[model samples]
Target: MSMFDNISVVKKANVYFDGKCVSHTVQFPDGTRKSVGVILPSTLTFNTGAPEIMEGVAGSCRVRLAGETEWKTYHAGESFDVPANSSFDIEVMGDPYHYVCHFG
Candidate 1:
């Protein structure tokens, strides 16, 4: 099926981090959930329980995956992967970091 062909059912999550992040949580028929949100300029670390794909939807940001010292940049339409049971650092640039996180 094409994208958005059967996307009429979706759920909204409460404003998180005092509105710094907001997103729509979508659950497909196969039981996968994806969170799409925008992250304000901030430095944060995240741990993943399941494998995730974080895609940049608007602004850009820098990320340092676990076991790496160098930071890589990801711009709009780009994406990065976080392995299950691992952590990563996120450095938001000058603008909001709009993203869609796909979980499996």
Candidate 2:
């Protein structure tokens, strides 16, 4: 799916880590929500309230989920799952990492 259809988007952006990460909430007609965002070149940790699937849209990133030791790389068209109430470390270098976050 190259684009989303019949969705409502929040006008304000969700800024984090001093704006290194930014996203906007997109709500679907079925009441599901997702976020489309880009992470600037940096290494950051994010805590999740709900379980999420991080789908890579552009560029690439190295991620280490909570309790993990090894780092795995995800490029465009790849995805990674994060558990609820958990955290993950993401490292994005050179180009910004674009992603769509599917929340549950």
Candidate 3:
């Protein structure tokens, strides 16, 4: 799971939050798509169109899902699910957080 084989990557970067977050689309042979990206040290909100599984690759982050009061921490090799049409707040400090977003 460290690398993806037989996949196509979109050349254009998906940049947001004044460049606080940047990612590129990775398409698989089966037509599923994912995003590989890094989130710089910042607090940000993201809205999702599709149900997603956020897999951490490096570093760590504190996440507060919509309507949640407690913030949870996720490190490398951890994953969190976000429901479709919902949003979450993520706070990254110190090192940049690297992740792969699986879309369903």
Candidate 4:
């Protein structure tokens, strides 16, 4: 079995992307903590199921799914998710961003 196989409670962690910040908590199954930050220039896209990716918005950026119609704006204190089997991308409208991610 895994080291965390017996874990039951959820663990929380904080991540900062660009200027945006978010807290993630994972429970049961795999007692892991994930934190992430992301910045995009123009537009960037990724395939789904690649992994669980989180991006924190710093300045001005837009996030949306590939071939989708709408783009959501992300700013400081905002968080976005990259779901499994879903395509997503981010467009940077300002400067380069930074994200602090921790996973265990």
Q: Where does candidate 1 stray beyond 4 Å? A: 1-5, 8-19
Q: Score every model by TM-score.
A: 0.83, 0.98, 0.98, 0.50
Candidate 3: residue 21 Cα off by (Å): 0.4
What does candidate 2's lDDT look like per residue over 6-88, in tens digits? Answer: 99999999999999999999999999999999999999999999999999999999999999999999999999999999999
| lDDT for model 4 | 0.53
Model 4 poorest ten-residue lDDT run: 1-10
Q: Compose the digit string of candidate 4's lDDT tens values, residues 23-73.
A: 444344554644344444556665655445454435666778767789987
lDDT of 3 by residue, 34-96 (tens): 999999999999999999999999999999999999999999999999999999999999999
RMSD to the true structure for each prediction, in A, is 2.6, 0.5, 0.6, 9.2
Q: Which ten residues in a row have the lowest lDDT in candidate 2?
A: 1-10
Highest lDDT: which candidate? 2
Give the CA lDDT, 0 to 100, for residue 26 in model 4.
Answer: 37
Clashing pairs in 1: none
Q: Show pairs that collide, candidate 4.
A: 18-58, 19-58, 20-77, 35-101, 49-85
